[model samples]
Target: MPQRTNNGFGLVRRGLAPALALAFTLALALMFMAESAQAASLSSSRADRRAARNEAKTQAEEVPLTPETFSHKLVLDGQAGSVLSFTLPEAVHKGLELTTFQDLCVFDADGTPVPFQLRAPQGTNQRLEVEKELPYFMWQPEKPGAGTPGTMDIEINAKGGIVRIKGQTDDLAKPGPVSYLLDMQAFFDAASSPVSRGGLAFADDDLRERAIKVLLAGDEPFMVSVTMKTSADLDSWTSIGRPQMLVRTRQGDVTLERDTLVLPGTAKRYLLLQFADSDVPIFSFAARAVFDKTTHEVRETIVPGTLSENKRQIGYTLPGRFPVTAIGFDLAQAEMMAVRLSGADDPEKPYAQRASGFIYRLERDGVTVTGEPFPVTQSNRYWRLSAAGDIPFAAAPGMRVYWQPRELLFLARGKGPWTLAFGRQTAVQASALPMLGQSDVQTAREIASPPTDTGATTPAVAKKEESREWVLWAVLILAVVFLSGVTVWLVRSMKK
Candidate 1:
């Protein structure tokens, strides 16, 4: 019995060792196959992304300006042999896949390509000098009998408008210097006038240095030294350094005059002009604020956005890829709320904060005051608004996105009824063509036309691509299952 048991155990050990080795080898092979498959899938995905990008670049470079290639079309009305220009419609902006409008082209009735140039809606940078007359009132001493100047207590409203001005006297019967208060709010409010509207629109840094031109119309030649003090709320006053001398001397033919004063740094809402000598004679003078306005002609398109709620935050997605300039909100109710605006090009990626501040739509003094649009320079497609605190809206607020439209200038070459072609994914930017100056070209009228629907993929092609992906996945899954079965079989054999 012992001899038989030993022989049987030896046979069992010999059989188990081979099975164990086979199972180990099969497990290793399965792991290697899975790793190779995973690596290939990753490599394929990266290659697809790169190929898509390269294909877009190639399309933009090689695609011909044919009506069939573009997804949208518009008719141009102008004479041939003349350079024509037109502002791109809002529909063009909505249909464009490229930010720079590289797919844009103009073709004649004969399908011949026309040379063209793309320009900003607003032409180029232009510098303008704007001057506005300031309203002023003089302050006098509280006691007329007192020979000394007295201090003045001034009150201002929320809009920085002066509400009241009262003179106060000290216990010693001494008074403060008499001063002239000028309403400097006109320089800060851009919407006050047409000329000043563009003044503050583009350049915020240029508003720091304000030029005050004073016109003194007095018969006698007088010299007076004046000191300027600025105040936002009449309570706090900031002195603008040393006093400046204002002199108007008369010579034989030429008159020597110093009438301009430049205030450095940020300007306040109210400016107080005080004379150095209290005994200086009161002269009739007019003062105006001068601003160096730099403006760029910009064409704006406002597109309504779709709103969605994401947990505590609200998000918005625009219908098209827009070079967003500003964001405006339409509140459901009159309320003030502080929100942080964030944006991203892709919805899957994290959004970056663009602007943060208070926005309100309030009714005050029988007037509706809506907050100005927050400025942002991004071409992002997704936007989110998060409340800064515990503020919650009664209803989902409506949003409007503002963007600048590109201008197209094309030379009319073949015939009438030219068509503008655009909206292609693979199209590249066309080479610039030198044509007649804008002053010499006539503005072409844009006639609305239906889009071409060139981006629609056929059902057959989509099915083929889908099947190809499924086949690849199925092969990988089968190989994994076969290796797993082989590994299990070897383990069972070792047990036997």
Candidate 2:
């Protein structure tokens, strides 16, 4: 019996050895298959990503513009030889896919694309020159508590003239025509005029006209009339006729201020200002000179927004992708509230704060004063308004957005009745071409044409790619299942 058992054990051990070797061989084959499948999948994914990047890079140059690919079309009228320029209307905002209008295309009657350039509205250029915080010395009557003629002793020589005026130690406490002498020597020196050295040739034409802006700090609102005089020589002064009024008054939340006084013509080296009203109790004042010159012209468009609201804030959805210049609110009732304005290009993205200020509509004594529109230069599709505090709105206010539409300058290539096509998700961006000079271009009139919407086209290439991926996955799955089944069968046979 012992001999028979030993023979059976030897036969079992011999069978087990062959089964283990076969199982090990099968395991190695399975691992190699899995590795090959994984490597292929990774390579395919990498290739797809690289192809996508390459397509995006060249799409602007390779893709041709077609009428059927866009959702909106407008007909343009101009001669073939002339370069045409047109300002994009607010209606085009709804069909814009890119903030920079890269998706916009112009095609002639024969469907051939034309070279175009986008630009801001052309206008007469203007520049503002400001001289902030001009230096001034206060002067008062020479004799204290006595009615006497004010004496100004001036010493004049070749280099410069210096004026010495005697007055009380506390000149601000006295009540009279408070005088201030403004030294314009620095302004003359910077203007590069001979007048600074007392040669007396007029300054540059750009600095001929100037406006003085004054900021007053006082406890109460006051209105006063001022007399201005200019002098090259301290002894001989020329009076500017007519007293200008400076006023500051507040009613409720609205403050009305008029502190700027326009000068007649070119100013001299010295400026003297005399206040007429003494009972107003003037405390302190600051002044600046502003020079404005027309530089270029600007064109803008204002569009009304569709209002929306949530539990936290109110929003305005603009129809077009606009480079917002300013935001205004139309309040039906007289109300004042501090609010913050925010904007975003996409609704899914967080709104960024653009501007924050108090907006008010106040009425008093049969006059209404509305706050100026908040100035903000941003490009966005959606805007939101939130209260600075927990202030609630009784009713929804109207919103108006102001933006300067980019001008499109295109060569009138091919034939008549050119079309502007826009609004496509997969369409390639149009390259910006060199724009012709304004003098060389003719203005093109836009004819309102109903946009044709050929519904979204299905991408056959994407569908084919997806099908290929599915086939590769199925083949990998089948190989894994076959290897697993074969391994299981071998284990069962070994056991038997």
Candidate 3:
């Protein structure tokens, strides 16, 4: 009976090992399932947010600014020293934050540009009492200000400059009361004789600034009036500026100068030039088409360079793959040069001339400007330049990159609450107007819980997600192997 009891106890002990191993394996499987479900939940949330952002981006609305869309046009009587206040409508106040004075335009009744200084937005104003309001024109009589009471129009337009491309042209022969300065100078020998009159038509109506290049011969001094006109169709003409007088006379034997035309900033397809009857022969007339410069946030990047065997070739590797706009060089020696860009890591690859152009350097009046700023067509990680001379290593060379940021402003037409979504290129979930203000704009460490998880996920979050999946699988696999070994041991012990 005692022997039988001992055998029974041994059997029980042998069975206990397998039972505990099976129990341990079951717990590991359950934990893995829980972890897998959690990972899936996070992934699903990310996908939903990404899909939402894509849908929102596809349906963005754009509003074209025109006179027809103005909510109100205020016409006010103006004088030289008049103190005018403009009270912004409720819509403008709620939508925009007036950060600078470059957000408005003032014009006169005759469509002439009226220049006025933006009165600083003050905290205390007894006049209009509007919280987000600014004092209107601080008029000056000498400039583009109203000398007397007249009609004034205000509009919402940002202050920006027009791109002016100037070139000299000798193509000034027309059926007008004008003769070339060369002809007049040869005939009369009067160094002061200006070109009688001339007319040259622009290829397009976008002309912003026009100037006649004047080259004076000898110490001849004379005054001449210049008249300009514009025609949209080349048939009908409208006078640009009243005949303005220009004088050219000095002790120097020769002089080269430019007389700019004060034309209004408007579009005109054809331009006519009339020179005041002086004996001075005109050199050339230059006209620049006015194009509004696009304002963008610029970022600068530095790239180190290595001089090649020939020493004239400088090779560099760009740090990032960002689209490059301009390549800058801090030259120890200034020389005329051109740059070639490529993506090849090989040093032997010959330079291509796909986007190559002349580099310019000018130093006058103690100011020096040198650069070759060109738009990039394709992205390249490598760059080589064959300068007129060898690029000195001591001079630091770099690259200026302009990134087209992945951001945009959308104006939704419909009333009430609006939502936005974007970004499938990454784990970041989505975006919206109001949600962006809280999550993106406000730098709070903790975001107001994302609406539907549209915002993007950080790289750290994504890495942890991947690690969790691997860890869960690893635990399950290890539990299975351990349990199988324990079962084998228990069976062997029971048989013994």
lDDT of 3 by residue, 357-439 (tens): 65556676878878656666544556776554444333435545443222222222233122222112222111233322212
Off by more than 4 A, model 3:
1-294, 343-352, 360-362, 388-396, 408-496
lDDT of 3 at 125: 14
- Structural similarity to truth (TM-score) of each candidate: 0.59, 0.50, 0.27
- Per candidate, the number of residue pairs that clash is 10, 10, 18
Which consecutive 10 residues in model 1 have the weakest lDDT in total? 456-465
Q: Model 1: how large is the Cα RMSD against the reference? A: 8.9
Total colliding residue pairs, candidate 3? 18
Q: Which candidate's TM-score is highest?
A: 1
Per-residue accuracy of model 1 over 235-319 as CA lDDT, tens digit each: 5778886788877788987788887777655557777777654444444443343334544444454444444453347778777
Positional deviation of residue 333's Cα in model 2 after best superposition, in angstroms = 0.6
Listing every candidate in turn, what is its Cα RMSD in Å to the true structure after a full C-alpha superposition?
8.9, 15.9, 23.3
lDDT, each prediction: 0.67, 0.68, 0.40
lDDT of 3 at 459: 18
Indicate the residue-level lDDT of 437 in model 2.
67
Expressed as tens digits, the lDDT of each residue in 365-385 for candidate 2 is 989888888988887878888
Model 2 misses residue 350 by how many Å? Answer: 1.3
lDDT of 3: 0.40
Q: Which is better, 2 or 3, measured by TM-score?
A: 2
